[model samples]
Target: MLLMGVERFPTTADPHGEPAPGHTDWPRLPFVPGLMSRLDLAYKRVGYEVLSVAEPDRRAVMLHSDAAVHSSTTRIVHALSHGTPAADLSRSPAAAGQEHVHMVPACATLGTGTDVSQWVRIAHQQAQPTLFVIDLCRAGRSARLSELTRVPDGELNAWVIAATSPDRPAYDGRFSEAVAEVLEQIADHGLDTSPSIRFVRWDRVTRAIQNSLEGLGSSQRIHTTRVDVSQELPELPFFPNPRWRPGTRLEKLHDVVPPVRAFVADLGAEHFMDRVDDHFVGRQSQLHWLAAWLDDDRVGGLRVVTGAPGSGKSALLGALVCSGHEAVIDAAPDIRAYLSAQSPEGVCSPNPLLAAIHSRGRDIDAVMTSIALQWRLPSEPERRWSVADLISEAGTLPAVPALVFDALDEAEDPDDLMKSLLIPLAGAVRPDGRSLVRLLVGTRRWPAGPLLTLAGRDGGLLDLDDVPVEEIRSDLRSHMLRRLSSLPQYIPPEQRPIRTALAETVAEALTEETDRMHEWGPFLVARIFGHVLATQPVPDNVDAAVARGRTVPRSLPDVLELDLDRRPDGKDLRAVLAAVAFAKGDGFPTEAVAAVAPEFAPTPNVAAGCSLARATDQDLLQHVRGLLDAGSFYLRTGVETDGSTLYRLFHQGLADYLQAHPYPLDSATRSEAI
Candidate 1:
């Protein structure tokens, strides 16, 4: 097969005219050069035939740069082919420009911004590249700040991504920091890894970058478009003759992390999980109320415990989960509980709870499993587990099961969740007229929101405001002392007496100041401790610093910013913090942060005097100790009870702060590594 390739460039200095020594468009073709590098390695790894088109002495207008010497045809075949999709690889140009294509300046400035038709025309001209990926974007006006995080379209299959919406200024090469990051990620790990026929899943790389860009705030959204291929391309692991096998029915649960995390992230803890330094105080009445719901003959009604953070509503719910309310223990000892630990606020469809997998990460597979397995009923996957199916599964069980959802107001769409999950479950009845399941919901009391009517309807209301100011003070004091214990270890043993005395003074001062604020949630108190630990040694004038309220935040968002300010890893820590903050309920994996900036994972922890790149899990944990505690701004979503965890902004305050102030990510900060 004779293959002839032509690229028109103003400069051709390095013999083959590759990333021409001084060519203007050199950097824009990063992937072009990158793939060439992979092709050379592909040859070494798979031993593909390397044919030289050049007749050495004859020169023969041949491609000769280190990476450019090899054939792209072979690289695309092994590194980019998806099954037997038919198309050849080639390039052409049309629609030289469009309105404000700010994504990749290096490419757009040259003559890139083109419509799908132009690309299709070009594809037809080239005989069609087997896997043609046209990286393009047309910036669009981002609406009011209120609708910032909303993606314009939900169904995306095209290859185009909006790196920068129209409102942003045009960049030099159309190459977003996001594109560079993913391309490098793909290169680091070979594009195609088929045991049999080697075919690259090009769509996965684009999709990964698209998803990552959303974390950059609403200004950058992504979409995909078809170029010219007509084959019904198969989904993901894009290899020819894809291999697979089925295992035991239960074995299929391995891939349910995102959904379960979403489910739990939206679900409230049974009550509250207290950090060693944090304590859950008061709300005994609320706990009893939750227990009564489980055992009461009248089933399926909302048992709401409402309060601001730190008010113990969540703790009351948590306690019930751990040790069912005492009222029910004597009457209904066999009752079981299913919990939703995170908020389900922003979801458009309640179907996330109905299916095992949801693209948006709102699946409830884990909860169903618990309910099914606990009752010894057939709990098929979420897709097949309808409301009727649940009732059928529970029909034979002697003990009635209870469902508790916490943090209703925090849900992306509390009103939607209430209508979809709460009311439906509440209304689900048996032949005896009693609802099939007991229900408990905990949320904030909104002054004027959709949940008021639902919150008021016949169910019991446990308000934290009635819990007395003195009880909160006692809880705050207890919390302060526990935080102080962690600080003595940070101080040198020789100076213990002075430091301990000073730290206690500071903690006492903080508690008093905290009691004055609104319910001083566990999170704010934790930061106060973080501040004390950070600026330790009980300065020569400790009494003065304590009295001055040196580090306490005026508001919750301020607390997050302050905590971020105290992070030990400098820029690296700041960048990762921003990502976790934006991740919200859908927490990220350890490697996810690494994808944004290769240097982040490898960056040195100058404060701890070690490189994070080589740090052990314990080292990583130690480095992020500030974020691990209860009420801390970030939470790590890990496999069941395992010390290992991936991070997300657990505190709503952090998410609110980031939405208001997308720092370390605004145009200026983005110029850096993140």
Candidate 2:
């Protein structure tokens, strides 16, 4: 790592009485030292050897008093670009045997002194993987740096993250500060591991920096440029997470579990798990059955859990993984006992008891790769492993490995997944005449074919539709009470009792509504009532709150419609929702929402209405944040592949709702619509 910065410029040099004509006497950046310190600390924490150009010898060469003999910036750029060994400017001596060099230069844009072209020149000479974190004004214009450094048809050696766009000036020291902050966060908290590896990539770092700057309300938009040489550079393991211990089974499992799965599990826990006491409530019978299936070696095969769209299938699967095998088995007594117990802490299972995967938007290769990783089997370079290979490998292990697949219907090719993977794995057996692996699956529906027939023959189908209505209602009530008890701290103490009573009234009203509408399950009823109670104005007394609760729409769609109608910025919020609804994969960043929001203009003449078409990017971002904060129940937030926050509908039902009621204006005709 090469860290360099110029806080201030000297007034005079030997031949040039003044510095270059365009160079400003740049103000002293007080935060430079702190930035360098933070970066050094973070890099060292993740086991990187750091070398700073601020060291005595390099500092003299960087800011030499005699510019007439040799320009300080010229020498610095030459040393960086060519690594002159004779002049003692080579970084290779310090970074000997290192495959990658990370260069962080925080300095002013002093004409040729800190011109991006000078930095781009480094990419041309360095053949090894190089990352340049350029924190300078108009750094976004340095997009060509990656292009200049590109190795055609090979692994990209150069990666660049610029502080701001070409048209905008970076705030003094703010970009560096944001970078330092993101580094510290990644070091301390650690990011979700990639599907194959546990390293932080350049894209992840760039997104983290962007999110950090946005969170701090800085106008600087971070830009990143990189080329994947043979798809290697994109997946290149740039930094080892401080938390990861190389070659550990636990770490391997963590690597295999997709970030989307973790995000969904978290989202499910928030809605279904007891928040007040941090306990998992309800689903005792199902939990007991699952526990028995896992414990019983004789009954080894595939077990399927089927339910309606909003019937808590994902929540149940999430509970299984989050609770772990032992916890779920122990918590099977009843809801009361479950509520009293401590919630499961970490998701990493020591033993290969449960290896789960979520199939949402994932292809067969990804699914197979995850399975291979979890099983600790030798991975092929081409990721050409088959279900037969997985089954064959499972026979080698002493203990029967349980594999869990959730949301199979959402896979890229559901039929292929079923026919090729799940069905074959379901019937797989060992030479000793025992099942090689235990399979657990959760889905809304299954194709009526061999797989379904096998499940039926084995009596492995656990239809949540069979779960009694009263039991579901009981769970819903418990969830509601827990959610209500954990009210925002901002609520006044004097109004606490009233709010508590109001929550109870709302819960009871929602339960009654569910009873009236038998089709509405725990997820649907809870989500609707939760949104209603969260968004509605808090009443002074229980009576008014109860009346408000009674006024909630009976049907889920009607409830969503009413909520949208109630918002003054309904159109803008709808636009955000549409973006989220249509987003592919896990979710999309706020930037994507802002980019597409303009097409959904507000209807004219609506009182106090504002159209997103006229909103600036910053304003759109703020509006999205406001919506997230206010209607958290309606939308879910997840971490994208690039380590940025992503927004999506809370449930598939919401997506269905949005699809049913499409935004009328087409993008081509949007201008006239506005």
Candidate 3:
């Protein structure tokens, strides 16, 4: 880690000893020294080697003057852009290795000694996973440096966090102080008690800093760039949780099984949904019904939320978990009084046990083990716990425990999961004729077994298909507007108005198309058309953009098929998607994708007018990277062990589509791909 603090800058002279124009001698922020000290101690406590180049450290290169600061900044950029040699490492604290963090707390202005352009230029040639925490005025503008340099997003490997937006000024010392406070809090008190999450992610850290700044009465908003690509920076041991023990009873559950990280990172889950929490609108009636059901002491069986493909079932469940039951009621004042009257104590458990079946699918054993661990059931080495054991354990707790499971149809054996775990847990009853546990499940279709019988008897099913057409349309439009505004391409304040108008126009067109065609729903329309509109150039007239939006296909599969047929590299893209869909375990690594894509490539022939050349390994890799950078609707990304990229289909729906309409390949080519 490299820490640089500049509280003051020279006004009269530049680094070259020339007369500096439009440069002001920034006032010294006394709190900077203390902030750096706190950070140094906090990082050391969390087992990071502390390297400081800030104030009052005479042994290291000091930022005492403009020339020194400028020279140091240039050297740091050189080390990051090029390879760091022994000389560079010895002269400066910045290291050119993977997972290095560079933090600067200074007054940055254009044409000043502390200008950040040189630091931002490092993104042009960054080859490792690097993080930059810029605490200065207009720090967020550093992200635009890539645009100015014409560097593509996939080529850049740097993650940035700025104290304020591009057109705003930051309150001196507040951002740095917030960072120190958050790091200290994580080091002293762990971020979460769940053993499934072993580290405090960078996204969580940014939220904590924002909350701290808000408490200090600062209106400045922090901006982050390339967040999705490097959101797992903390998993690089950026900040290890002090409370995570390796051999605890809960930890043993994940010993042979894969970690639930993929489910946690799902687009509909808490981590990703939290980014768009404000955009979540509508679903009040559904939420109200769920709230009433959760609070009712008379009910304890399963409450399945069923919907067709592209329906917003996942989003609704995700919102419920992100915002607790009370927040839901508080958002709807009319329903709050009635809900409070029904349950005076409260509507639901404060923190429910939440889990989603992995997209690749989890077995019955893994499913039961996860539930048992979350309930804090004691692990017995000699005996394996069953569904009955979990039910009995829940009855002993002071309050009833709620178990929320999503994507039940995505399980390895849906029938086994329904029969072995969910069915029994739903029917478990206490001695007083009350339900032992509260169960909620989300699935694309109803299971064909005893689970259906339970739902029929209890009347606990909430079918999203039954939602009014107008309500669904309104909710989807709201979702599209929110999604458009949050795209990284249009995040700057200057681009907001144009994107807003375009979002409104596009949302209207897509919602109208959905009305004409009954199959399309919220998930498909928002994802498909949102990506389509975001990638297109902004029109000079909002009215003109509406015409362009009307040109989109009427159905999800048609849009996907159109994309496959139109692109120049369509065949190669399909090959990569197939590889990801058929991949075992988590997903396919970039190296594996590159190796397998060529086998599925088209054969050269003159009769069919096949003019495209065979792609090399480098070409294949670059193609995949470009797709990810362009925000392909079909692909999702993960990090490999060496910090490279991994690729997977965005959801099971896409995989299903690909399976139904597979690309043809010759027998020899198909065998090689297999």
Candidate 4:
């Protein structure tokens, strides 16, 4: 991760100090800000420590050392390991800078007017054989990479990997970024996925780097050479090779507890097609800002993210929470987990704080006991499990935990949540005297009055709808293609094999519709896949289909009406859906729903216009299940503590729709309300 910044910097000086002539500040220059840190992050992402390194203002600073060290390291050799400990030595900065010391045909390209012999001498001084990846300009005037530096006989041979042979400029993190990706790719695939070679040998890294360029969308080619009998690098992994076990990395894996794993896995990224073609595409700036904010020593509190339906709010939050992803976003160092009321898998609870705590593998019963003991809830033992009680308990947590509350507006008790869980959690204090929690909540803007009180001045609001639409268009396009490509592998080859041409057509149409209509979201794309797939003779007119699809009303009343049209007994389906949609807490008990649903006296010839002799609750339920499976409606079904299946819709939009357009129920419902 060490970056030897080659750029010039401005070092402020008193005009009378007579800095390098009119050059106030020595034309002072240092490494790129965050560049070295990013490279370190790259290796750390793969569970390696490249050691002490970089950003201009970061931990490692390469001050204006003498140029003499470039060609001759005898006097000023201490520059290499100044800030960094002896155990950690950098490989990139020096490598990239080495090119500047080489000879060109007539004149050197940006050289210090010295040969690379000094650098060669320094390479042999490393504690272990080092892998030196030099960034050499491939411009027509440059010499061959191998010719630039020659090692003296009897010295230890170091591995040299060169980003050369083709013309290219070394910009911010160019070679470093590509190198990071290459190592990560190799690590992910494991040595078995690669061609047979010694896993820890230089040959493996060389081949993998070259092969990785294609996947990285890079034209840069890297060449490698081994000077002699170099030792192996234990960092290279081989899944099948039992003999080559990863050290320290295994301990790191165990440190990530099961509860932590569950919390992250539940995030959308670890599941579905998200792991493959994740399209959190346009929110890098937001993510980076969030990462910096989260990791900032000066700030710690709630970060609220809101968006209209289909704005990809959940996906963005999920990316930040999932494992391996935290590094990409530079999240807080100690993120226990991220919990959302509206998990992509539809797993939720009425008491989200409780759910989140339990998701982290914390003992909810114990947490409740501790809170009850400390704060004294009502005399009744059962009342201690309430949202406020749990929130109080969260404040006494062992660590500065992070909790992500997604879709608060979708909570069964938004007001109760605001008063008990959210407000308290927002201002909670940890047992150790630190803040109670680091929270990121995603929800729609609603019941604005209460939310505003919680927001205060420190709160942040990121409205997905407020973001530039072009960015969302790109994300949706990528998501659509990824989803399209996943079908064949996910669906058994024996059934409904997708033709490449058909997939391309559908993807193009879906992307265009989502982008053109500005309606691309996870839900919309999923529904498109379902509806379009059902159509026979996959239509060639993608745009026309997309146009027709958008015409499917988004408004609740219109949507309910459209869903009703899908079945023959539209009235029965609609009534059942209305009951389920309006049920409280994901959905009240089935018996409760039946009590409120419209009922009719038994008719002798009920089979006359309808298929069923009489519409039993089971019949209506079967129809409801079809609607749920069709994506026309969004509902979650979970078992209650009493063992009955509770069905409710997590979508606040649908609930709003159901409220405005209540079914024409003939049942005695005024007294049967939940």
Candidate 5:
């Protein structure tokens, strides 16, 4: 085991003008922030003290300690021999306007009183075309015992670099282990004499590895598994002000004045008719504002629409997509007039457009399949990028080609799927120049990390409140009417009164000057419908069902509380809630769930239901009703491969709610309480 150490180069800030000798402010360095933590851990593991040597002299920034002076001196000689200047190396600034600073490679050192034979073995190991790890915590640098193998401490010093930044921290143990393994392999293979290890610059390591992989073939090239070092930073909380201040965003809910009403309606919930008429009933003026923004030819770029869950962000995105799509298609004639003339108005008849959309992933794959069905592309010799293939296989005219990624945060594997895959695909432009692509995404504010990054990088953010309440309300009304008419139970007597009462409630609630009504759309549409439906007089069990249902609870908030309260024994109900709320694929099966909560498995007959089948059936019904109007949990149920019915949650919000308001854990506590 070769030893390694780090000399913390403390930079002295300038008392006058120039920085004091060895002075450095580390965070500003973009790469340094990400690199510092790793190197620090590596040096610490190798058992040595890291010292800052930032002197102007060529030998500045040397690993200094009482032990292993020969190794340290040898490292300096190696640097001098390499003709590498002894100036402090600086990294690019991470944040704008931050000062740049210098950072040296991590310098390793040896400890006192090591076994001579062991030192020689490790030293000879280092002399090979191998990575010498100085585990400062456990051991020091070992001197080579043999005349044939001379390990320069300077060579080891030149190998390591200071960790990135303290702010952008990283973990160690495994990372060290990985590095150690690679080093050990290099020594065992006698790679030093054969290929002659080329210690490339630390920064060029990745490129060197890649080239080597290609040259040596995959089997021979060691794929350096870079640890996910980004995890060290403390996770920033979602909200700055954790206290849920009542009525902050609520005022927009009502704003009966034309401007207010239009903005409220944009939230996509016409079900809250009372609020609509009272605060935002007939505000048509805001549509003109949106129309003007949409019609602007100069604003031809990606745009983002964002808001809280009930804020009508999705509705606005749909409306925008519909508006610009035609214009975009119409503009394509300028790129290729002949192609446009050959294709029908709705047909995707452009090769470039087809290629752009077919770049990657299942979502796009489904979109392509639908296109293939519509275009009636021939099943003969399958065409790749031919014009006929484009016409026949392509679905609709991808005019304006607005790739609207609705509810990005809702997507499974958001980081890898959205950030890495979908987003990059959407940003690509067709080389043929027939159509323009724009990406618009909508998501709730809670998990807005990637979305926020997208906005900052490529688009502008649009708050839902920016849209007029009246327009939103009008759209809501139309949507509600359509939905109500579609539902079999909501016809005639039920529709008329429910519609009337809903309208009145919305108007009254929204018109009140004291009430902030803009944010009420999602809640009113979803929650109110859920409550009313649960309370409805069903033909099967009007009295008995009503009695049981009434006991179950009526409101959205109350219903959630009831479900949580219904847990028989408080065996980590919070865990149960979390497990159910964030099930991997919508929901988990009873058996799968039992794995998450094994204690409940033995008493499945009583705790869940009679049998697994009965429990699953009942759970499905509960899930359906439970998800109907709630903002958080959405129910998904189906039988699994194990012949057991499974259920899952649709949103992360339910898990968040559970974590925030958790119940007591375990059988002992429940028994004691009983």
Candidate 6:
């Protein structure tokens, strides 16, 4: 891309035009050529395709410079744009539009020893580049009074007027010195990963840097702002909504059709589709309470909305977003405008969450930016403001809307999150001396104390137990009905009622002795239903089954016992069955089996103790044929106790039944078992 600079005059000695080599004082330029060269080189070095253009309208053409090329300009541009020092220069512009062309004459007066505003005017006029106005007066101390470490200065600028004055050393003297020092530091150290710079005083842009650097660097990001540190900033209302509506620019964009669909596809409609809840029923009363909390014309703070697991917290949050709150919907446009003003990039940051905040609009972006900045994610540039800084700076932002953070537990660190985020945000007073924000957080039980404290301190805590049971019931019934109705020849739409009844019956039966069935949530209810159907006889046994279903044993042994009692073969197979039962879980641990009923250990045929030997004589083998065919037991390999292995009851109920009811022994020696 071509990196073109639109200027009234040309610095290059054009091959096709007159060279003004002798017309200017080159020595007094303060290495002006070097500065410009540095910017060009640095931008190119960072992989930005660079090109120089005196007249952009003309196809970018190269001209050999009559004067020596200085690297200062390239380095300065690179530092300002990417927070990186100059490295290398690209031979040519890589592509066209990707080039970040810096407009010249930004501080021509500074280097030429002249006025400052002239450069600002020139820089401001250039539409293609981001404006950078430097003041050489900020070379040493800053306007604001603050302690700072020494650093080199990188940027060069002219001063039309004194940035500092005697009446306020805070604004002028020390401030300018501080600013200059910071620039010098940037020049010397290059850009470190940590953008930890902060500004304590607005007018002391120079000095504030000194004050802020006393802190440590952040591992995440850096935040900077246009907020005045010395004076209190006016609280700005949150920005208006950014949602596209009729006759709006977004509407026009959407009207184009293809792109709008593409945009929706990009937003991952499918991802949230299953999780989205449209009408989260049973929370109407709670909704009203939340609305009232938001309307407090008094001090603005935050509210904690909590519930048990599966209490539909996510659903409710979705519903709130759709329904539009007094603070959010009404003021969306204003918030959008504010965000647009702050970040023209439209929030497409590399960070997914940050990107979401950016694209949605400014009010959200501002809040997210503040959070990210506090984490040292570089809200603006090289450094981030602290929590105190954010609270102070929030004044400049648009309406601080009622912020909502759902699924608090899902955050990386809930404890740190509560203390750092919720605490300050909850206590944040408005610019007008009232609370600026009304924050809302949704989390499950096992409540964090900090969260509770926040709730106790001026904010209301509304338990979600009151969430309607009907909603859960509705969700379950709908799911079951949909599944049943899908059968072609079976379970017609009319039969959906029967399915629902069956589901409800099963649910009630399982949870009747427990708690409210709906309170168990859909997942747990489904598990209970699965147990009922797995062992219950289907279709033919429907009626007797419904009544006896509750009687259904809760484990495998119970099922086996019931099956054995109803069948004739089980009686004849008494000895084998008894022996199998005795050797229950994990093959009944051979030694323990010998102690309990040891006659079986010596021989398969047992006449003593539990009547195993006698039962074996009565065609027990004949009776056991069915069970053997059914894969219940296999022959004992190796020793009767050692390698013993066979099918045992799989469920707890079966093992419990067999263990609880021990067969009576007939002989004393046999009864003693081994």
Which predicted model would earn the best lDDT?
A: 2
Instruction: Please give the TM-score that candidate 1 achieves against the real structure.
Output: 0.45
For TM-score, candidate 5 versus 6, the one ahead is: 5
Runs with alpha carbons beyond 4 Å of true place in candidate 3 = 1-263, 268-281, 295-299, 324-349, 352-360, 381-383, 446-450, 487-520, 540-542, 563-568, 604-633, 638-646, 664-674
Model 4: per-residue lDDT, tens digit, 1-674? 22343334335566666554322132222333344555555555545544432212221221222222222222211111111101111233344543333311111121232223334344446434333455434321122335433653234434455554434433333455566565554454332221222243445456656665555567666654533335333332211221233443322322332322222332332232223332234455566655555544333477777655555566556555542233211222222223221122221212112222112113344333433433333346445476555655655544344555555565445565556566766776665666666667676666434554465466476766666655654544444445444554424443233333344333344345544333334344434343344433433344544544344343234434554555455555455556666665335654555555453212325553442225464454343444344433344444333223456653445566566555533334422321
Angstrom error of the Cα, residue 19, model 1: value is 40
> All candidates' lDDT scores?
0.40, 0.57, 0.55, 0.42, 0.34, 0.35
| Better structure of 4 and 6 per TM-score | 4
Q: What is the total number of backbone clashes in candidate 4? A: 6
Error of 4 at 539 (Å): 1.2
The candidate 4 region of ten consecutive residues with least summed lDDT is 78-87
Q: Which model, 2 or 5, shows the larger lDDT?
A: 2
**lDDT comparison, 4 vs 6, better candidate:** 4
Tens-digit lDDT track of model 5 for 1-674: 12332223234465466654433432222333222344434334333244322221212222222123334222211010001111232322343112212222332111122222232333333332222222121111121223323323333322222111212222232223334332232233211111111221222332333343343333222222122332221211110111112331222222122211221223322223322221112223433343344444233345555654445554444333322333222322221232123222312233222111111112433433433432344444333333334433322343433344555565444455455544544454454443234445566655566556666575356656555555554544543444444445645563565644443333333323222334333333333343344334433333443333224222233345444444442233433444565455324644344344332223444554323222343243333223222322234333232222345443234444443433433456443322
Give per-model TM-scores: 0.45, 0.62, 0.53, 0.42, 0.33, 0.32
Model 3 Cα lDDT, one tens digit per residue, 18-67:
44443334456666667777777876776666556653222222232223
Residues 1-674 of candidate 2: C-alpha lDDT, one tens digit per residue: 55565554444334546655433343455666667777778666765566555522332433421231132222112112111111112323233221112222233222223334344445445544455566765565554553454455245544557776644566756777787776666665454333224566666666778888987789888766745525534554456555443543323233334632442333343333334423445676787677556655555698888776667777667666654533222322232223325232223233345677878788988888877776677666777876777788877766777877887887788889888888888888887888877888877664525555678788888877677667765665666556555656316676666655655555566556444444444456556666556655567676776676566555565566566776776666776787677776667776787676566555544465674666575566566656544655566655555544566776775776665554744445433322
| lDDT, model 6 | 0.35
Kindly report which residue stretches of model 1 are placed more than 4 angstroms away from their true locations once superposed. 1-275, 278-285, 288-300, 309-316, 323-383, 388-397, 409-413, 445-452, 455-459, 490-535, 539-551, 566-568, 584-586, 594-633, 639-645, 664-674
Instruction: Give model 6's TM-score versus the native structure.
Output: 0.32
Clashing pairs in 2: 154-229, 155-229, 156-229
Q: Please say which candidate is ahead in lDDT: 4 or 5.
A: 4
Rank by TM-score, highest first. Answer: 2, 3, 1, 4, 5, 6
How many pairs collide in each candidate, listed in order? 40, 3, 0, 6, 72, 83
Q: Candidate 2 overall Cα lDDT vs. reference?
A: 0.57
Residue-level lDDT of model 1, residues 183-250, one tens digit each, is 44444333222212133344555565575455433344543333224333433322221212222211
